[model samples]
Target: MDWPAVAAAAAAGLAPTTPIAVTLANRVIACSAAARAAGVRRGLRRREAQARCPEVHVVTADPARDARHFETVIAAVDALIPRAEVLRPGLLVLAVRGAARYFGSEQAAAERLVDAVAAAGAECQVGIADQLPTAVFAARAGRIVEPGADALFLSNLSIRQLSTEPSLAPPSRENLADLLWRMGIRKIGQFAELPRSDVASRFGADGVAAHRFACGEPGRGPSGRDPDGELDAVMNCDPPIDRVDAAAFAGRSLASTLHRSLEAAGVGCTRLAIHAITANGQELERVWRCAEPLTEDATADRVRWQLDGWLNRRNAQDRPDGPITVLRLRPVEVVSAEALQLPLWGGIGEEDRLRARRALVRVQGLLGPDAVRVPVLSGGRGPAERITFAALGDELVPQANPDQPWPGRLPEPSPTVLLDDPVELFDADGNPVRVTTRGLFSTDPFRLDAPGRSGRLSWWAGPWPVDERWWDPALKSGRTARVQVLLGPDPAQALLLCYRQRRWYLEGAYE
Candidate 1:
């Protein structure tokens, strides 16, 4: 492939003069003669490129966009060779048997595929062999071996190409080549000739694999179907979109792509990763994991939530230098889509809970994140004891056991309403009475008033006093006697009042 040329063109920000390709890492996946002649070399960083060749410009790597572009190139190649698998961002592997028959020869088919990709906006080098890995190696090395020449073709190349892992050799590829040269085994043929037992004992499995590759021994076949298959989509803009609306639009496109991919796989995802590339080449990545596996609409909602969360975090710190230009959405975990069974009477409670959760999320998004809360009961014995508003997501560790009974505590199905602060009142006889904040009566007497009656206290209900938590000062002051008032026209309209710290007040209504 014209990897060197492509690297040069990409680094220099120039149109390709000839067929060349580059990998995602910006390495020379292929290059043209003109680019190589311009002193452009493979594996040079974009910044290092300027020192080597002043006129060369650099383009940041855009894997998703590049993959999309490569799809067009692959379509063109498919016209010439029906069965082609895209092996990497810039590499292809094809079953050449059919193509060779259609084109009268394997070389002809290879040439046609190369030309087709080049015409489709890529500079490509093509290689055909009995195996995919070997073909990839030959293509990277800019060689197109004749059929049955696989052994001869690989026998002269360096062994570094045999393995995909970069750290197989401690000494590096160049050092390994140097070591082989010193051993008088400069070519793959000589390396392969080294006794297999000796190679295995000396360099371990990697060396054995390399030697086998040089000997043209086919390696293991393709892996079985990917469990977490590739499912991602991206949106690219000509001028690099920075507007929130533009990014949101791109998000919608990506969501649609994810939906299609998941539908094709017959699965749904619970987690997703979002990536945003700014115009200045900075990348922002965020992950969203849902409490429940998400529906399609919920997935989009999460995308928006994630975007807003990231933006707020970034803004709170400091705005980035540039506007984000590209947006990518990728689902990380997938499970088989199962039919959701509904109860015959319908899950109205669950539906209501979901609506409430959505409302809470919106409120939290608008206000600070801690603004929304759910009520939780505490161990103390006052209005605060009965309930506390805790921030959402906080642990709801029950302070008291549901099964074990507290001797003096109110029974299950506690009062629905609790007044934060109690109100004070005087009896019609003008006698001072005492009540605990829990509405229990103290030693001081409290007279109850009839319902709908303005002034007179009719009768008192409780001297059912409670002296609790005397050991703790905070609790001692809070826990006091409370009395139930049969106020107004009916005892059924009785109000629960409390006397605390030597004062009487209405604490709660007994509905």
Candidate 2:
């Protein structure tokens, strides 16, 4: 479900038929189906979307509002399955076996849940499958997959759908989908044919994870064996926490303590149960199931989301009469972290790597999905173009085939940083340095200058001609030449400089 668009329309008091776009950072993140018909799409800038469809209603993305409104729907689903695990604010999954047994058929259970959601004032469809990801795809098509036929069910799906549905593939992996298509793996089954180990080596850890999803394997491979002792974190509110801010503060504290405990046990939580007691003695609980192990910040997010849902639910019968007085987090399922397969090659050991990942995830949660990124090797003529930065947790798919010959790639020991704002080089007479048509410097460069960096050149190398993508006129970069320059006494103080269109610019710096 595109919850953002639905929540935005409802909050703005717009009818469901009205085209809506939920924007964040001045770009459309989600849009109503009607908006799609009108040519508005996600990732389009606000002005472009408006130009595409002038009647499209634009609204800001509000996660809290989305959670609040979705609470009623969650409650309705809970009525059918008390232990149903919430995957996100608008999505949930229940083991169909018990429900099917109770309702006498899987179809009946699906219809029952659909009607329940309808009564809650939201439309929903149910899909049953052996694996969650397959079920997500099935739900989208409103079809029930046959028993143990998840692979068959997923075989024909376009790789396009996996990235579009956040629950199936994450960290917004539209790039992964495109990479697969470019590699001639247009369908889920085609990609699934690759061996798991080979996929890991070629596309990295996240790719293997996606393979499992495509193959209809479990969400993650970590086995959730029982741990030695109780792993629970609790916090009691002195004055009932009535505000979302207060709940968030409490959640962070609890999450931090819980994370330390999990690390000590050398395990991670795949399933978490959030328990709360209201001032009126009403007990509320919800369980969250994650595709991968939960980080501290992710746990806190679940806590905050659950509390917000409870506090803001509009149902008169189900709403908490009094504020929440107690909150407890319990690990419903724990997996041995030592069994957790992290990236095969990294600088740090397993423990340090895990800690680093947690910190990055926490920062991303605090900031946004783009707050942190990791490099994925890509084919290019320059050091900066050799790799692309993908957000952490996403598949490390290359931008282009690295195996293909890159005739003019920079020599070994590439620069550590690529300057977005290139530095300029000036001649002894203060004229901008340039490489002549004869493939020689127009004038001897004297100084290199940038915002915080300034130096007189000590020594310099030849301006090697760079001609890239010459075969594709649309993709071709105009004539440029690179030079290596050292400043002052240290070999460590080296810069990668480029001359283009009669102007000198700094491309990178050697560490």
Candidate 3:
């Protein structure tokens, strides 16, 4: 919550003293201390927040921005304790036993951890308990309980804490706590004293978990699954792989190794992790999830696609600095192959998908990744803007969500052809046709003049004018006026022309 407001203010170059609020869906989700002082609070409507704090600076809540800026905080904690599990942007949990032992005491470790984060420019509180849930609550209260006192410290707390405390458990358990409250078990002590068998019989596994937490049992916290007995495929790229083809070639064998291992274990993966490390020590990881368990070819294809995306970034600056030095494929989630029931119909079988994958891989190898791209229809005002490109095996996500209303965006019957470059429009006298700031045509277009073709204009429609981001000069793309015109001596060809920066250019063509 604090991270969102701090990130927003930081982006706007506002000091920590500034009254700021971050809103999502027009409701205030996070507010700075100054904003709170001014009466702006969470859950308030944007207008209400502004009404309460007239000087408040409101920003749209961007989870991406929050996470990006919160990396500093994570880095700070990780410096002392590697691999801390981040529960949320601001909440992190880990077993600090080793750190405490090294520092000679838990409180000293907590103090140093707090100081480390403070040095990183964010204030943090630390808590230590025998169990995770109690430690989470203790952290919230900004206290460190002595060892073996987890139950005693939590006994008097309201039962709602189980539901409200984020690190303790999920909200489903909160519903159980609410039900317990209705039954007059209003404190953790009461819930802890309930018979484990009775709780399991009445409320089930979630209730049992809740009971464990309330009893201060060292419940399973995400220490990551037992890796000692786990099978993972790892390969070192000795000379390093800088090209997509090489990476794809290497990924195939590695995927085969992983599948063979899984096959021997009689299981198949539904969710798999692709982990790569650059020669420069930069780590890249992505998770691929499938409806059905992944086969050998399916796993290889996913790895290849992921490698292609990493290597074939359109923007050169976004590309990795060096070749990948290592690659790993780990099955994070799996189920027995026999447990999966194939659909009766209407789905492509594994063999068919594998064949399609091989065909795409061949095309990607023969032609470079960029040369073979899949077109995805995206939301945009113009025909040229609506089409986006992704690498052959890459996933396609819209440039902008089509569901959102885009004012002033052009309606379609989209044009059949989009010109690579705009063409000039001229009058019958061969004088340049122009558009005024008021959207009026200086002279009617009577002829179309492009590099290889010229023709007399037969008819035309529209001088549709659009002004985008006029309020912010930095983002403004300049004003543009468009027209649809037919030009030819015999059979006229219809064209879309746009006038901008004192020149007319061909935008698209109709069939």
Candidate 4:
């Protein structure tokens, strides 16, 4: 999450001390320290955050953007520690036993690791505890507990810590903690002090497991499974393929090979890294995380996604100067296949989702990336401004923060068909019905003539005034007013019309 702040700071040439918030789905997901100081916090609505910090830079939370910037930090940590589990783009955890032993003490190891991350242009906190959860909480507080003090350090923590402390907490643990809190068990110590057998009988296996963590008992970490060794599939580009189709073809084969090998070994990866090297030595890499164990098609889809994100640039400047020379898929974190629980009932089954994804990939290959775009909600008063298209495989971030109060947005029952070319609107005299400079209608819209039908207006809704970006010269599209009108008498059809530049046009249809 900090990566978003870090990325925004770097991109905008602003100091890391500047207040910033990365918004996703119209809520604050991550905020910089300066923003937090200004009363901005996680989960706050965007408008509330803006009210608190008017100068705060609001950015869209793009996981790909975060991961792309985070790769340097990973490389830096890997230089110090051979392998570290990247729990997410920003959060990472690695066993410090070896590093501490080599450095002669845990404190010394933590300092060196922190300094390493600092050198990579990121501020990081390192903490050491016998257990992973305790270590993570300690790291957030910038503290390290003594080797045997893990349980003691966690005992006094509030039950709410179960939800907030960890990057990802099991839903069961969160629910159990809430239940315990209602029963007056507010601290971790209280829960831990309960008889283990009783807790198990009351809350089942998840409760017992939470109890163990609460007592500072060492739980199995990522190292428990031990990495299966360089289980990555690599594809070499002999002539340096530039077209997305060719690169995707190679990715499909490599993805198949990688997944087949993992399935044969009876394990599956939860997080996989897609690494690519351009002909000019520019390194492009991304990590794709999955909720369920990745199947062959799932793996291939990710490969295509990462590839599309890199190769399909919206502008010339965004595109790499050289073609990709090498592409690699490395399993960064693996889980037992049995750990994934397949849902029995849902909207669409896994097979259907996979098929849909494959179809999207095929379209991207055939029509180019920009042709198959996905809509991301953004802040704007106008219909067109409210949604921006993101290229397929691009980590979708809003173009505008949706939580902002758009003064003149169209009301509910949005138009379904947005016309590419607006049909001209006219009056009974065949003269264009115009909007005046004072935001008033010059004449009533009496007749409607278009491609398919010609009829008198049956009914009409008011011309809602909309004036956007009136000051910014580059974006000033001038003032316009919209009206929802019923075109025909029998089972009247709805049409959204806009008036600007002394002319009226059909903008969309409610059908």
Candidate 5:
């Protein structure tokens, strides 16, 4: 609103010579007069601010803190006005009709608002008008115009202020004002005089609302409360955290926020979104989903997992110097409160599946999200083509029975040891004879090797040469090697292995 008042208030929180400024990461969100006079303006980078105002006091914008502080100020106002809606951080909207009647005038209510914010350790400029946007601009402009004179008051103001929607667009406030000047709408009053149909056809709905706002007409009803209101809360840091540890600490705060919100709403959340704001004005957003509704511990675990995920995804070339300043956690989907239902007879393995899912998530946190997977049967004849890694909790399509049994398919009970990249092996004699490229290998009758002695290869099996998917390039051109092996008990009653890659390696035993 009033740049001077905002500057003064912001400066009051800093050293006298400190050029106070607010930034959302690297971009300046707001700046004091002293800072501006030194050439520091909103949207300037932190480096640019330092270059312009060497003594600038930079404070990262903390929307949650501002929101909390605003809530306290509004609570005080509610003590007097009873009903109020917080439109944004540092902005409050109230029905002044009742408050004005009680306080004897709208000016009195405005004064009270300013006084209340001041008492709450904040200096705010209050604006009183019929339209919310007009009042907002009046507040920012640092003026309190009479209720009935809003049109006259807005007429002289730049049209840019009418189009201000902080949460939506990125155009500079001054640029919007300049555009209005070029459009020959020098004042809010002139813009308001334009036909609504013409305004809507040209500038869209936002423009129409701005026009009505300039006319001093109430553009809309009070801001509606978001249905997922319990998902909101603020994190306050002592001495202002500015390190990586601060982000970790903020994660705890986010967990607490979610816990409180969910407790109040009597529900649990299935998904949470964390928004981290850095001192340099950068925002990192991450979303976490749980297979089951989460508890407080689970929520924290998810947050930690998300942070790790972010670190893994970022390039080593660029990393933040300081810790995150603020972390906002919002639960996007809240599930109804329900107890875990256990089957009386336990016919299906649902409990085991749930446990497996949790274990997979834990492993993912330790190894990396993509490092672990469950093998699912995909409809195909070849071994490599039939098996696919599935993410935890994903539904699996059953493998179809081939029109004819795969002639070379391995016998029941697949090998227990499965390596991602299997090594090649050779026979004891160092001969090149081994398993076929298609998982078929001819082995001479062999006996198992024992600690005391070695036996001969006995009861050799398949030399079944099976051709795999020759059509698919990804598999055919690369991993199309076939394999053949012999299965028999060794002298020690343990199964021994030999394969084609010009060497002998233990594949596995057949129990």
Candidate 6:
């Protein structure tokens, strides 16, 4: 039942100051205007950013909160536009051509959208273009491209914009942009001029997609695919399910069935549409747009997030009045599967992963979701922070990262034993060891007095500083200090220690 679990948790750590930097995997992804003025930039690690500007507040990323709060924005948009395709929580794509006509002009429609969202307490920009990619770039620059100038608008832009949409672009696009930069093809126009055949032969499928986007063409290209008849997975919820917990279980099973159908057909889903019917007969549907094919877990995540948002809506008009009686997942867009190169000898674990997943699901069914959990690696600056637990059948999504690195993190040989409570650390005088407000250790630790963990320290390591979330009062823990100590015979056993406000406590133990 313990499941050796880890839950996905990301919390920002730093002083509560105006110049703030939000980090994931220890690298900066966003910063406040104040931080930017002080020389902090995206991709700068906390160590370097601190050197550049010492007053900046560094925070870790929290994906759940981002998605949870974004639902209100999505609801605001849904009120105006029925099905604006959500690419991620903050970004969306909708065919504004019709809205432009209805509003009398494209500019007018955009203004209306901005006002609607602003009413919901968020700022936004709109872009008009002949193609999706062009529109995406136009939105970034807060400009409306001319009726047929999608190509021209994107031509002069830098190649770095190739990965403009993080939720949509493949990782290779970023690498491709770097490759082009090194080859002297600095502008998108230059890359767009390459021969299609050459791009296909050299850059492969992803390259072809990028070329098409830069040329003001659609990204799907000529796959000429079909989801066939079995692509839609529907479930008739007999007793009805309105609670988030029930929805989570349904999402897991439905996601697996949908993927099995896609896998059997040698295709993958690109866009997913979730439709639900409540007991009151109210019908609801939302479409999700993705840059690439949706993996089973990705599909499940979207399902869970969407349903959770709908069920938890604070607005009376937005929340469902009754339990859901019918639920269906339809793949609105599909593409042919491409052969993937494996690691040659290490690709066999996929079957094992799937088998383990099934066993966990069976356990979940027998004992309930919370009883079966699994450990997940998440972004953080501390040992316990790196690990999180998720219900077995749910998607294991890690928060805060396109990559994982923690600067100020302790070196490896992680603790094999985690302590539930902090143990007291003592000096030779029987007085508790302490840390000063200036982050200085009061004195060297001498005796350990933690019941069975008691011992005399032979050697010790730091009083390393850890400060997180001072800005948010509900989540802030003032600056804390940590140290490593060898205890018992030869100080044979090792222990991790934490100090806060005149108290010392055991954190963990090493083998």
The best candidate in terms of TM-score: 4
lDDT of 1 at 394: 33
Per-model CA lDDT versus the true structure:
0.56, 0.79, 0.75, 0.76, 0.55, 0.75
Expressed as tens digits, the lDDT of each residue in 133-153 for candidate 6 is: 777778777799988788889
Candidate 4, pairs of clashing residues: none
Expressed as tens digits, the lDDT of each residue in 118-221 for candidate 1 is: 77656677766775556767776667677677788877775444433221222234455555666777577778778899988976655665667677777532
Ranking by lDDT: 2, 4, 3, 6, 1, 5
Task: Between candidates 2 and 5, name the one with more favorable lDDT.
Answer: 2
Tens digits of per-residue lDDT for model 5, 1-511: 3232243344345544457777653567677767888998876777788898898776655433343234445556666665465444456666677777888887788788778767755567777766666676777777777758878987887666644655222234445557668988776778778889987887764565556667877554342333354576556554445543334445654675677667667777665666566566776654444434666655655555444333332334334344566667777666666532325776488558545655665565466545666777654433444576754422333333233345556555655553233333335564444555545544443343433324545444544343555566665232233333443344332332433234444544544
Model 1 vs. true fold: TM: 0.40
Flag regions of model 6 displaced more than 4 Å: 1-22, 31-40, 44-60, 220-229, 339-349, 362-370, 376-511
* Each model's Cα RMSD: 21.0, 9.5, 9.2, 5.5, 18.4, 7.5
Better of 2 and 3 by TM-score: 2
Query: 282 in model 3: Cα distance from truth in Å?
Result: 14
lDDT of 4 by residue, 269-368 (tens): 8777788888999876555554346767666666764565566543456566689998888887788767655466743575587567667767776787
Off by over 4 Å in 3: 1-83, 86-91, 96-112, 119-122, 125-220, 224-230, 240-329, 332-380, 386-404, 426-432, 451-459, 470-477, 487-492
TM-score of 5: 0.42
**What's the best-to-worst order under TM-score?**
4, 6, 2, 3, 5, 1
